[model samples]
Target chain A: MPGYRSEHIVSSYEEELTQIAQHISRMGGLAEQAVASAVQALLKLDHDLAKQVVAGDKALDALHRGLDEMAVSIIARRQPMASDLRMIVTSIHIASDLERVGDMAKQVARRALQIEGLSLNPRFYNGVKHLSDLILRQLKGALDAYATRNAAEAIAICNGDDEVDALHTSLFRELLTYMMEDPRTISQCTNLLFCAKSLERVGDHATNIAEAAYYLETGKQLSGDVEELQRVQHKI
Target chain B: MPGYRSEHIVSSYEEELTQIAQHISRMGGLAEQAVASAVQALLKLDHDLAKQVVAGDKALDALHRGLDEMAVSIIARRQPMASDLRMIVTSIHIASDLERVGDMAKQVARRALQIEGLSLNPRFYNGVKHLSDLILRQLKGALDAYATRNAAEAIAICNGDDEVDALHTSLFRELLTYMMEDPRTISQCTNLLFCAKSLERVGDHATNIAEAAYYLETGKQLSGDVEELQRVQHKI
Candidate 1:
């Protein structure tokens, strides 16, 4: 009977862990939707859709608060040690990253609203669309890695950040050239620059999530490879 | 004897809390120094100083990790509830914000390096210097509020973010005009725009810290006032 009671306790703890993981997955899904909606809103110049994306951020924020509170409560109640503790702590970290991703999406939506009614060059629009598509792919891949506990996949997603940075740099240079070519395009290009920046930040938050996943599986921080990439990009 | 033992436990808990607070203050000082140095580097076109600022971020990152580990360990070992738990959790949040503040400073430093040897308009330089000064003031005020557990002071700091946003918008417009007026200035102005954005982000992080302070004291999240301000600015 004593052994049976111990087994019951173990199962209960496992249940709680499963619940936290589910919450994180749900939060990731919401963040993914937010990013996709924001990008589509930008491309279609849909003001209503942009407003919807902006309004959706509150839900993401609330989910983050809920996940954080749950993680803290589980720690206090269960006193989870080692891998279990790491999982809970890393969930909190990933939730924060997801919340920031939501904010980035909202910023894009706001920029889309600001640029409404301005006739922008189609090439600039195509550049932003392409960049956000790459970011969205990174976001999805990182979330998948988190769900599967795949550190290798997470590292791959992180390495992809260099490509995102390179794209952003080229887009920035292109937009600058556009503005310099015709002063009339300055306002629209400026808005586009901000949109590009928001997408770039989304890629950054995705990398943060991937790093969290790597830490969760290995109980170690990812090395300085990403930082090295950032430094190299900065030099350029 | 029981009463005395309880008092001793309370004192030790207070000691742990004090230690965490001190770490946060130290981290904030590092972040403040980094931002000031980066901005000075930009104004003086000091590549070496900018490199120093970039290197300084690793220390901030290490401090953040130390603070986070301490907070998590406290939560696990002490099983703190109510205000004690809130304080520890909020400390973690504030540390993350400070670390990101350090990143923004590093970004400014990198931009300074990219624009080396280019003579920018003195007006633009003055504008960036002024913005950084305001942001640094806000950061210090927020830190003070956290140290004192003064929710009112924290709220005031959060409200000050709107002014930062307004200053950033004006700076953006002015830089856009500069780029338009002289295509030769495009590269320098673009770099300046990024620096302005970085400073603006530092202010946003300050507001995040202030909000965490308010939450620590009141056990309630600050309302949507800051978000409302953001939305209004987006409309502009």
Candidate 2:
């Protein structure tokens, strides 16, 4: 009878864990859509779509709050130990990262709204679009790695941050050159610069999630190679 | 004898709580010094100080990790509930914010290094200097509020973020005009623009810590007023 009772308790605990994981996956989906919509809004200069992206961030925030509350409540009730505790804590971390990703998307959308009707250089917009696509891929990869507990994939996504940083530097230089060549392009180029920055930050948040996934799987931090990348990126 | 034993346990628990609070305070002090030093480096073009700020960020990161580990360990071992759990969780949040504050300082320092020989406009430098001063004040106030568990002071700090936003907008406009007026200033002005942005982000982190402080005290999130302020700031 005791064995059966323990099994029942374990099954309930697993159910709660599954629920939290589902919430994180749902939140990730919303963040992905937010980024996609915001970038499309920027590229098309669609004020309405940008507005939608801004509105969509609230849902992501709500989901994050709900997920955090659930995770904390489970911790308080279950008093999970070792790996279970790490998973719960890391869920909170991932939710926070996803929420910030949503905020970055909103930032990009706001920039789009601000620069509405200003014809920017197509090359600059194309560069930012390409960067956003790459970040979105990283975001998805990180989330998938989390779902599958694939630390190798998570580390790969984390390492991919160097590419984003490189692209951001190039975009920054290109924009500065454009503004120097045509002073009239200063305002629009500045807006694009911020857009690129938002995309770069999205990459950072994706990397953060990748790190969280690695920690969740191994119960250890991925420090060495990632710290080296950060040092190199910091020089600029 | 039993009463004495329980009282001793309570005291030990309180001691653990105090230790976590002390770590947070130490981290906050370091972050404040970092921003101040980084800005001074930028103003004086002091390369050594800039490098110091960059190197000092690792200490802040270590403190953040230690605090988080302590907090999570307490949660798992002690299984704190209600306000105690909230306090522990919020400490982790605040530590994360302070660590990011260090990163922003590092970013400002890197910009200082990149524009080492260029002479930027005095007016623009003064504007950035003034903004940094305000943000540092806010950082101090937020930390003080957290130490005291004073929700009122925290809300005040949170409300102060609007001023930083307004100043950032103006500084951004001024820098853009400077770059447009003199193509030769583009590189320097771009660096200054990032400095302003880093300072502005520091303000956001302060506001985040303030919000965490309020939540720790009240066990409730201060969402309504802060969100309203964010909306007003975003309209710009």
Candidate 3:
């Protein structure tokens, strides 16, 4: 019976890993949709789309919970080791980052709803739209890198976050300048500032996922000093 | 020999759990220190202390790595199930949040160094100082709740985050209003906005830790819908 149980666990190990990967893909797709819809909602002040983005977070949360359960169950049941364990561990971190990305998008969508009734210059959003576009690309790249196990692309996403940060800082000043120049626009610009912040955080989450992917593929941290740790993992 | 091996694994299980708990405490302590020192550095514009806060993040990072290694090793070697496994898993998450708290404080300290050359009225920091005070208390409460396994306190910490969120928004407006009133104050207010934002994020991270703590202690999510899942864990 003990031998049979061990074999049974081994038989399903690859299936479980594949299921986790597929779940990650689905979650990434959902997260990307949330961020994309949030941008469209903000740009068009589309009430229905904003509502959908806000409501969509529940699905992402459910998926996050599912992924956590799957990871924990596999680890506890199969007791996978070395690379398998690292993959499961990294997946948990990546899923956590993706969940936060959903949260950021939800915040942005809420702000869009907040400023829905206001009449604003489209020019007001060009900077924000630009930031969102860059973040969306970064997010997409990160997801692709994770799926394909492209450590180079993952590293690129991490490095590209600085551009996102610089853009955000500049946009911060631009939004505040609008408030300063036209006191009438203060409320709108304040909401816009928060939206910009949400977008910036999405970029941060993307970087986190990329870093996690990088660690998964390389057994090394993007920030270094992980070589020794990998040795320990192997020894254990 | 196989029986001897099983006995050895069981013997070290408690020690491994204790080590993880102790590691979490140390990481939490360093996180609190980083936040406290960052506040002091910002209030006094003390460059040395700001540098110290920035440098302190490395130690927190090291401890996070150590905790992860310990958790992974125990799980792979001992293959602990049930509550022992949950404790190890929760410790990893708590350490991650604590590490992020350190990162937030480091950011605030960096802002302190950025604005070190500016001469300004200390009154400008009154709102910021108050916000930091609230955030520090929340972070400390969260750590203590986790240490004591007080799920009620953890839930209270989660509820208290709304106050922190509201305070951050008000401070955001307050700082922007200062900029509008005097364009000359824009740069200073901008930095203050970022520092305030960092403090707000610290509050958010505290809530995350509190939620994790709640889940670990109760085997249920603070936000509910986890009863079925605990049943699943028990079945596993």
Candidate 4:
């Protein structure tokens, strides 16, 4: 009787979990596209493309809200406990971070619309582009960690956020000098600076998601077992 | 015996909810002060004040993270069902937004540190300062809505975010002209722009919290309700 009840319950729960994971993956894909387009819009001064990014952000926002509704329904209907409940709850937090990341992408695109066709130093754009790329990679890695239930990979990604933060600081100072030297470049420089900040924030949200994934896979928190994770992460 | 079990559970849940509310209020107070000091730091170009603002932000960040951990534990241990779960989860989202609001305040302070004794147009600083004030008020109103279980008030506060956005856009355009005209004004103007954007974003995060509160109280989402909130916000 115990075996029968447990089998039926777990099978139904797994079905819903699969559906939820698919939705999250869909949302993540959209977020990545938004970030890339935001950077492209900035470099090209493409207002049309920028507008598209902003408009698409509404969809991301809706997806986040919709996913939360679904997760709540799952919790209510399924009565998830222990690790199962953690997974669903973690999705809710991930949704919030993803929505904010979408907003950041929108902010960058809006700034692009404001300062169009200005010649920025190639190195400057390159730096911002690199930051975006790194953030995108971290986001992908976090999603993979979720799929595989790999807490070690997730913890490693969270620690990588410090690198993103350092890159942001370096880029901020570089942009500051550009505006400091030439008044004409100030508007464009400020916009790009904000764009870099936005990307840095996206990296942070990714780290948050990674942390959530780790919490879901393991009943422990990385914050509590930092030393353990640090040692294990290095070996991995 | 059934009635006694129910009563004991209800009272215990009430006690935890009360504690959560108190902690959020305390965090809100710190957030209000952070925004205020960051603005003052920019207006006065006081690096020491800015440094203090930065330090204060770290504490605010820690408080936000701590509150989130507490809320999570409450939900996990208490196993809040239905609307109770939603409310706790919403708190987690609100804490993250508040933490980022603290980060933006630190960003403003960091900009202040870069510029020494340089004063910009009082009009510009006043606009940003007023915007921050409005956002703080909105955050307070939203939190009240949460504590009191008032959906309409939360909706109203969420709508107030538009005014802040409009002010930021106007300030950005005006500041651009000033920077474009004078090289020496670029650094100060850039800092002012950062403050303005930070205030605008703070308002946005406040609205997000209001939305979460509304969802928790009513268990109904007025999708794209922000549009309507903006229309009714004038009365507030």
Candidate 5:
């Protein structure tokens, strides 16, 4: 009878972990949607879409809170060791990162709301469009890495941030030049700069998730040292 | 003798928690120093101080790693419950916020390094200086809330972020107007804008710490609603 009860407890523990993962996936979906919708809203100057993206942040935050509570319950009830413990802890960390991603999307959506009625050249939106797309791809990969326990994918996403940072800097300069050329466009361009900065932060948060994902899957930290990371990335 | 041994273990556990608090204090001091030094470096264009601020980030990061390890060990060994569990979890989160504060300071310092030798009008740096100073005060209040377990201070720190955001936006406009006045200052003005943005983020991270600190002290999440938050502030 005792053996039967122990096995049942084990199965239920596994079930709880599954539920935690499902919560993460749901949050991930919302985060991805928020970023994509926010970017589209920005590029298209669609106020309705921007409002939807802003409103959608609440759902993501709710998912985060749910996942966090689930994590703490699992940790307390199961007192899981080693990787199980890491999984629960890492889930909490990753949920916070995803929540922040949604917040960044909200910031961009707010900017989209502000930058209405601006019919600038198609060229002005091109860099931001590309950067937003890059960030989306990075975010998706990081989430996939977390879900699938793919250390290689996580490391690649981490290394991929350099490109994101570079693009952000280039866009910063490009926006600066535009503002200098046409003082009239300064307000609009400044909004774009803030949008670009938020997107840059999204990439940074993705890097953070990828690193934590790597540790969750492999139970090892990504190196902070540039040379060490370079070698690891080279190998990967 | 067995009872004595059991009591000894309990005392040792309490001592370990004390050590954790000390680690947090050290981190708080480093975070405050990093922000102060980075801001001074930015305002004065002091390259040496900027480099020092950047370099000091590594130490803060090292402390974060140490705290994380300690937290994991405590959780695994003690299987802490209720407030005890929250203290460990909250410590981990606070360490992260402090680390990010250091990261934002490093961002400002890098901007300072980039803007070397451009002796502009004193007014150009004034707004940035004020913003940095305000952010530093916010960060200090948040850390103090954590260290002292003061829920009221935590609430105040969270509410104070509006002023920080308002100042940042104003500075954003101020810098834009300056750039518009003189195209030659666009690059430097852009740098200032980025610095202002970084300081603004420091305020954000500090607010995050304060919210988490509040939960650690009172076992309650700050209300996300403006009305509820206003009610709580009025009570405080």
Candidate 6:
């Protein structure tokens, strides 16, 4: 065990990069679980399940602290620069986005309890599920890119944000129709809207992760014009 | 002007660090202005001003790009290690928090439009304004700590977060009463609740900057058992 501990210590510069990447992968796993729990809670309207998802938030928060600690330790011990520095800084940002993703999931679970008895359009549920899946995939892809330091994969994931945004807009319009059709559906529809917004926000966090990955690989920005993109696609 | 360009070309490692610091300071200044403008629009109920603030989100978004560029450039050129690496990574997180601070200000402005005619309990407004001031001071103090490498100031700023949390709880309870007092206030009251939540979040971000500063100075987490503290405070 003593020998194992010493071997685990990074003796060379390259090993330090490997260590940071490992921590980021662990963080990704925690984020994936948080998102899964959030969707599960929404689908079943299960209060117990929702609370379990909320409880997972503590773990996710802990993940950020651990990642940050590992990062600071790496910087102190390794004296990394250039791409290595980018990786550490990017990990820090991605950790924050993941934590926020956990928060958004909790918000969805809160809405689930309020909308338990209320009817939701099957179409709306399906759209949200699809959006959640897309966000999950995007996050997975971004992490993969970070692990491999693959700029191409990172850019691909960044582009995937558009599809998520489109789904969110369509979901918004469909829900608005439901609210307008029946005033009695107002509260439930409103709650659902917030849930959809939460999912959309998860997509945004994924996009942020992707951007970080891209920067880590290239040390340059991708697009650098989120506003222009927004203007062009006003639906965002 | 020619002399300045010559100096730039001949700039030493320390000069680059100073240059990055100055740029971050400028970004922080812009972020501060954005928050002030957002709050001004809210207090004055100026929709046009609010719209302007919303539009200016692009500029804040652009600042993220600028900060990343500066950080990467510094890392590439200086190859800073240990405490200096912590400083650079800390700047990256601070930039992100300031960007979110800008977004929260925009959210406050949006809430103002929805609650145009409603009279908020003056106490609630005062509570929020007080919290906002505390966050502003915290941000300022955190930056000062970063500049001076002062761990004590950073710790003091972190302690101030508790005051903001207490105020948030009081505001939440007061808003709940307003919602219960009359259903008519529900919609507008909810908007105000979001505004208050946003301000509370700003305090949280400021606290994060302080923690980063502490890490830079001490090379160890000054605060004890983050997970335990998170549980006790229910920060998650």
What TM-score, over all chains together, does every model reach? 0.90, 0.93, 0.87, 0.88, 0.95, 0.75
Tell me which of candidates 3 and 6 scores higher on DockQ: 3
Q: Judged by TM-score relative to the true structure, which candidate is superior, 4 or 5?
A: 5
Every prediction: chain A TM-score: 0.91, 0.91, 0.89, 0.91, 0.95, 0.86
Arrange candidates by TM-score, descending.
5, 2, 1, 4, 3, 6
Show the colliding residue pairs in model 1: none
**For this target, which candidate reaches the highest lDDT against the unseen true structure?**
2
Segments in model 2 whose C-alpha atoms lie over 4 Å from true places: A1-7, A118-121, A225-236, B1-5, B225-236
* Tens-digit per-residue lDDT, A33-52, candidate 1: 99889989988989999999
| Total backbone collisions for each predicted model | 0, 0, 0, 0, 0, 0
RMSD of 2: 4.0
* Model 6 residue B50 distance off true place after TM-score fit, in angstroms: 1.9
Clashing pairs in 3: none
Candidate 5 residue-wise lDDT, A1-236, digit = tens:
99999999999999999998888888888998999999999998999999999998999988887786787777887898877888888888889899999999999999999996876667668988889999999999999999999988988899899999999988988888887888888878888888999999999999988998888877777855456478776784
Q: Candidate 6 residues A176-228, lDDT tens each?
A: 66655665565676567668878888888888887777777776676764654
Query: Which residue runs does candidate 3 get wrong by more than 4 Å?
Result: A1-9, A116-124, A225-236, B1-9, B116-124, B225-236
Candidate 1 vs candidate 5: which has greater TM-score?
A: 5
* Candidate 6 residue-wise lDDT at A233: 50
Worst 10 residues of 5 chain B by lDDT: B219-228
RMSD, every candidate, angstroms: 4.7, 4.0, 6.0, 3.2, 2.0, 6.5
Model 6 chain B weakest 10-residue run by lDDT: B227-236
lDDT of 3 at B197: 82
- The per-model DockQ list reads 0.46, 0.70, 0.37, 0.49, 0.66, 0.24
Residue B118 in model 1: lDDT: 70
